[model samples]
Target: MSTYVVTGCAGFIGSNLVDRLLAVGHNVIGIDDFSTGQRRFLESSLKSERFRLVELDLLDIDALQRAIKGGEFVLHLAANADVRFGTLHPRRDLEQNTIATYNVLEAMRANGINQIGFSSTGSVYGEAKVIPTPEDAPFPIQTSLYGASKCAGEGLISAYCEGFGFRACVFRFVSILGERYTHGHVFDFYRSLRANPNELPVLGNGKQRKSYLYVQDCIDAILLAMEKAPEKFNVYNLGVDSYCEVNDSIGWICEALKVSPRLAYSGGDRGWIGDNPFIFLDTARIRALGWTPKLTIKEGVLKTVEFLQANEWVFGARD
Candidate 1:
C-alpha cells in the first residue's frame, strides 16, 4: 500500500496509470491542469476513496510542493506533448515540461522524497543514425522543441539523483496508442474520415516509419523498471520490437472502419517541422527485466481506431 504521487493524472497515460495504482491497493494523489487532459479519463479513479485528484498546474511551485508533501514516489508524466505545433508557442514546452520537471524535483527534495519515475520520449534521438536506436545511441541535434524540453527534464532528474541522493527511472517512450488516446495521427485520420469517408488528407508521404506501443504495455514497462532496475539514475527505451510505416497504419485503420478513403498526401517525407521519418527503439534493456509488449503495432493501431469509434465524445471533450 505504497503512496504514489502521479502528475498528469487526468491525461491519457496518467489516468491509466492511476487506475493501475488504485487496482493494486495503492493510495494515489493525481495532479493535472486539464489543459490537454480530460476529466472523463479520471472518472473511474475519482470514485475511489484512495484516489485524490488535484486540478493544478505544476508551474505553481507553492501549490505543487504542498500537494506532493507526503508521497513516497513521484510518477512525472505531465508535459506539453504537441510536438508538431510546439514551435507555434515555443515557450509552452519549456515552461510546461522542463521547468515543471524542475519544480517537481525541488518539491520532492523539500519533502525528502527520493524516488521518481519520469516519462520521457524517444524524440530526443532526433534523426538518429541507428535503425533501432538503443539507450546508448548518440543524441543527435534535437528536431523538436518538445524533444529538447524532455531532454532538459532528463538532465535535471539525473543531476538531482547524483547531487541530492534521489533515485530516478526515465522511460523514453515511442508513440503510444490504446484506450483513452485523444491525439496523434490515428486520431487525426479517424476524425478526418468521419467528416468525409470518401477522402483522407494524409500528412507527409505516409511512408514515415515509426514504432508504437500499447498504452498498457507502456505502463507495464514503467512499473517493471521502477521495481526491478536498481540504478541510481536509470533510463530505458520502452517500445515494441517491430516498426510500421504510416501507410501501413492507415491501411489498418481503414480496414477497421470498412472505408476506402482516397488518400491525399501532403507532399514531403516529414509530416511536420519536427516529425521524425523513422523512430524504432531497441527495447532489449526493458526486455531483459522480463517486460515485453503484448500487442503488435498493427493490433495497437486497430485498437486505437476502435477506441476512437466507441468514444467519439473524447474528440469534442479533449479539443
Candidate 2:
C-alpha cells in the first residue's frame, strides 16, 4: 500500500480522491485548512484507519513539509479555484495557486518524496485559437489569473521533475462534474433555483461552449496515468469526446429538478472577466490508454443537480 499526501483533502475533488485512495487500501495523509473545503466531505475518510487528516494551510512551508514528511507521493490539488472572482482578489492566485504549488514541491523535496500528481485546468489555454486544444497546443496569452497561476504551478512541477528527479503526472482538466460538486455554473443555478424556482440568473449568453468529465472518470484517468504515464514528466488533457453549451447544461439541471425557471440572460459572450466563451480539450492521449468516461455530459449534469437537491445543506455549508 502506498502512502500519499493529498493537499486540499476536504475540497470537492480532493475529498473524492481521498475516499478512492483509502478504498484502494492506500495510506493517505490529507492536508487542508478548510478555508474553502467542507469538513463533512472528509467524514468518511476520517473513519478509515489508513487515512490521517492534517489541518494545515499549504502556505506554511515548514508545517507543510512536516505534514508531507512520510508520504511516498504527493497529490497537489489545493488552489484558489474561484476563476470568476480572481480579478477581485488578484493576490489570491499568486499566494494560493502558484506559491502554494511551489511549497508543495519544496515540501516534497524536503521529505524525499519525488513523485507528484498535480491538478491543472484547461483555462491555461486562455482563449485558444485551436478547438479541442491538444496537450501540445501552443499557449495563448493568459486571460485569467486562475489559469495563469495554475500555469505557473505547472511550470514549478515541470521544473521539479527535471531538476529533482521527480516523477510527475500533471492532468489539465476542463470543468469536472459529479458527486460532492459544490461550485461552478450547475451548482450556482441549482442553489439559485432552490431559493426561488421562478427565475434563474443565467451567466453569459448561455452559448458558452464547455466540456466536463465525470469525477469518477477523472479519478480513473488519474489512477491509470499514475500507474502507466510517469516518464520524468507527463501531461494529459482530461475530458470527454464532446462539448456542451451552457444552455444545454441548464436544460439538464432544470429537467432534473423539475423546475421551469425564467431564464435571466446577462447579455455577454463570456460570464465573467476571465470566463472563456469556448473550452474543449482533446482527450486522445488519455483515451489512447483505454480510459473512457462512463457518464455523458447530460448524465453528469443531471447527477450534479440530483446531488444538490438531496444535499440542500451544502448550499448553506459553502456560505
Candidate 3:
C-alpha cells in the first residue's frame, strides 16, 4: 500500500479523496488548518487506522516539510477558491493558491516525494477564444486573480518537474458538483430560497454557460491520470462532455427542492468581476483515458440539491 500526503484534507474534495484512498488499501496523511474546510467532512477518514490528520497551515514550511516525510505522493488541493470575491482580497489568491503551492513543492522536494497531483481550475482560460477549450488552448489575458494565481501555481509545478525531476499530474477541473458540495450556485440558491421561497436573486442573466463534473468522477479522472499517464508533467481537463446554462442548473435545483422562486436576474452578462459568461472545457484528453462521468449535468445538479437539502448544516458550517 502506498503512503500519500493530502493537503486540504478537510475540504469537500480532499476529504472525499482521503476516504477513497483508505478504501483502496492505502495510507494517507491528511493536512489542513480548517480555514475554509469543514471538520465534519473528515469524520469518516479520521476513524480509519490508516489515516492521520495533521492540523496546520501550508505556509509553515518547516512544519509542512516534517509532516510530509516518507510520503510516496502528494495531492495538493488547498486553495482560496473564492473566484467571485477575488478582487476584494487580491493577496489571498497569491498567498493561498500560488505561494501555498510553492510550499507544497518544496515540502515534497525536502521529503524526497517525487509524485504530486495538483487540482487546478478551468477558469485559467479566461474568455477562452476556443469553444470547448482544449488543454493546448492559448491562454487569454487573465480576467481573475484566482485564475492568475492558479496559472502561476501550474508554472511552478512545471519548473519543479524539469529542475528536480518530479513527476506531476495537474487536473484542471470545471465546477464540481455532488455530495459534500458546500459552495457554488446550488448552495447560494438554496440558502436564498430557504430565507424566502418567493424570490431568488440570480447572478448574471441566468444564461452564462458552464461545465460541471460530479466530485467522484473528478476524483476518478485525477486518480486514473496519476497512475496511468506516462509523462513527467501531465495536464488534463476533467469535465463532462456537455455544458449547461445557469438557468438549466437553477431549474434542476428548484425542481429537486419543489420550489419555483421568482428568478431575479442581476443586470449583467457576467455575475461579478472576472466572471466568465461562457466556460466550456474540452475533456477529450481525459476521456481518451477511458474515464467517463456517470451523471449528466441535470442529474449532477439534482444530486447536489438533494445533498444540500439533507445536509443543511453545511450552510452554517461554511458561514
By summed lDDT, the worst window of 10 consecutive residues in model 3 runs over 249-258
- Stretches of candidate 3 off by over 4 Å are none
Cα RMSD for predicted model 3:
0.7
What C-alpha lDDT do the candidate models reach, one value each? 0.94, 0.92, 0.92
Q: Model 1: runs farther than 4 Å from truth?
A: none
Q: 237, model 1: CA deviation in Å?
A: 0.3
**Top-lDDT candidate index:** 1
Clashes in model 1: which pairs? none
Q: Tens digit of lDDT per residue, candidate 2, span 70-144?
A: 899888899999999999999999999999999999988888999899999999999999888999999999999
lDDT of 3 by residue, 1-319 (tens): 9999999989889998999999999999999999989999988888899998999989999999999998999999999999999989999999999999999999999888999999999999999999899999999999999999999999999999999999999999999998899889888998999999889999889989999999999899988998988899999998888999999888887887788889999878999999999988999999888899998988888888888889999988888
TM-score of each: 0.99, 0.99, 0.99
lDDT of 1 by residue, 14-40 (tens): 999999999999999999999989999
Q: Which TM-score value belongs to model 3? A: 0.99
Give the number of colliding residue pairs in candidate 2.
0
